[model samples]
Target: MNQKQSISYVISSQSSSQQKNYRTKLTAVLNCTRLLLMQELSSRGHDESKESLNKENLIELLNWYVARRKKINEVLFSNAPRNDQMTSPSIHKDLVHCCAVETTRSMINEMGDSLFSILVNESRDNSIKEQMTVVLRFVDKSGHVKERLLGIFHIADTCAQSLKDAIDAMFPTHGLSIFGLRGQGYDEVSNMSGYHSEILERLNIEELSGRTGQF
Candidate 1:
C-alpha cells in the first residue's frame, strides 16, 4: 500500500485488539506526531486510540518516510560546499549590491545638474528582518522619466534615526547629497513619513531653512 493508505489504515485499526509488535506501537506515536504537527490536523481524533497497528504495514510506512527524508537531506547538504552551505545568501547579496551601486552611480553620472525625487519605503519580509527600499525617480537629462532601485538595506528598527542612518550610509557611495536633493516622498508611516515623522521633519525643515539661512 502507498504511504497515505497505509497511514489511514494504521489510524483506523488503532482501536482494534490486533496483535502489535513494539515497532508498530512506536510508528503509531511518530505518525501521530507528524500529523498533529499540522496543528489543525493534530487537534482532531484526540479521543481515538493510538497504540494498535498492523506491525508489517506500520514498519513499511516508517521505512518509506525515513528513506525519503534521508534522500532530501543528502541532496541539500551533500553536494554543497561547506562555505556555500551557509553563506550563499550573503554572496548573492554582495553581487546585488555591486550591481546596484554601479547602476545608481551611472545614473548619477548622467544626472548632471538635474534634480530628482527620492522615494522611500519600508517592508517587513521576514519575521525579524525589516528592509528599506530606496528608489530614485526623475526626468533625466534626456527628458524621459526614469526610476531605479538604489538598494534595499536592513533596518534594525523602524525608528526614525535607524531609517536615516541606513540611507546615509549609501548616499556618499552613490554620489548623493542632501543639498542637491529636490524632493523627498514617503508614505504615512508614523516615525519616518507620518504627519509628524522625524526624518520628514528634519529634511523638510532643512529645505525651508536653507531659503532663510537657518536650520
Candidate 2:
C-alpha cells in the first residue's frame, strides 16, 4: 500500500480490536492520533503551525480521554483495581519509537533501487567505544524519496578489510546490491585510509582483471 493508506491502516488497526478494555481503547486512539499528527507535521516541515500541534495540547487530550474512560471502566467494575497503585505504565516513548522504526522499514521496502549511496561512520556512544553506522540513501521507482538506517554495526576492529567484509555480509543479508551503489562515503579511518592496500585497492585490482570483486 501507499504511504497514506498504510498510515491509515496502522491507526485503524489499533482501535478496531473488540477485545480491548475502555482504557486500552482510549490509549490506542490517543497513540494513533499522535502518530498521525506527527506524520503530518513532519511532512509539512518547519512550515507547520506549532500552536495547533503542540505536545501539551496532545497530552491534555490524552489525559482527558484517559480520565473519562477510567470512570466508565469503574462503573463496569466497581471493585476492579481502583487504587492509584494499579495504574498502567506509560509507554509513549516506546510506542513512538516502534512506529517510527516500522515506518522506516516500510519506506525502504517501497524504494526498490533507483541508485543509492552507502555511508559508513563510527562514533562512541554512552559506552565510550566505537560503533559503526551504516546508512543508505535512495529514491523509489515512483520517484519518491527514501533514506534508511541499515543498522549500527559494532566495530570488531577499525580495519578496512574487516569493515568491508562486514558490509558485504550485510548487503547480501538485506537483499541490497552493490550494483545499485553509486558511491561509497567514509571519513578517513586509520585502517581504511592507511598506506597499506585496502578493500578498495583489492577490489580495483580484481575489477581491472575482469574478475568478480571480493570483499
Highest lDDT scorer: 1
Superposing every Cα of model 1 onto the true structure, what RMSD results? 18.7
Candidate 2 residue lDDT tens string, 16-89? 33324545544544464565557563211232233555434334344455576764344232324343212223
Per-residue lDDT tens digits of candidate 1, residues 1-215? 47656867766665543223223433443453344333433122223223534323323344345466643233233333454332133543454445455656787877766666678899898676899888887788679988877778888988888887886786676777666666667786777664555675654445554542422
Which lDDT values do the candidates have, in the order given?
0.58, 0.57
Model 2: residues >4 Å from true position, as ranges?
Answer: 1-18, 22-65, 68-101, 140-148, 193-197, 201-215
Task: RMSD for all candidates, in order, please.
Answer: 18.7, 11.4
Candidate 2 Cα RMSD (Å): 11.4
Pairs of residues at least 3 apart in sequence or in different chains that clash in candidate 2: none
Sequence-dependent TM-score of model 1: 0.50
Q: Top TM-score: which candidate number? A: 2
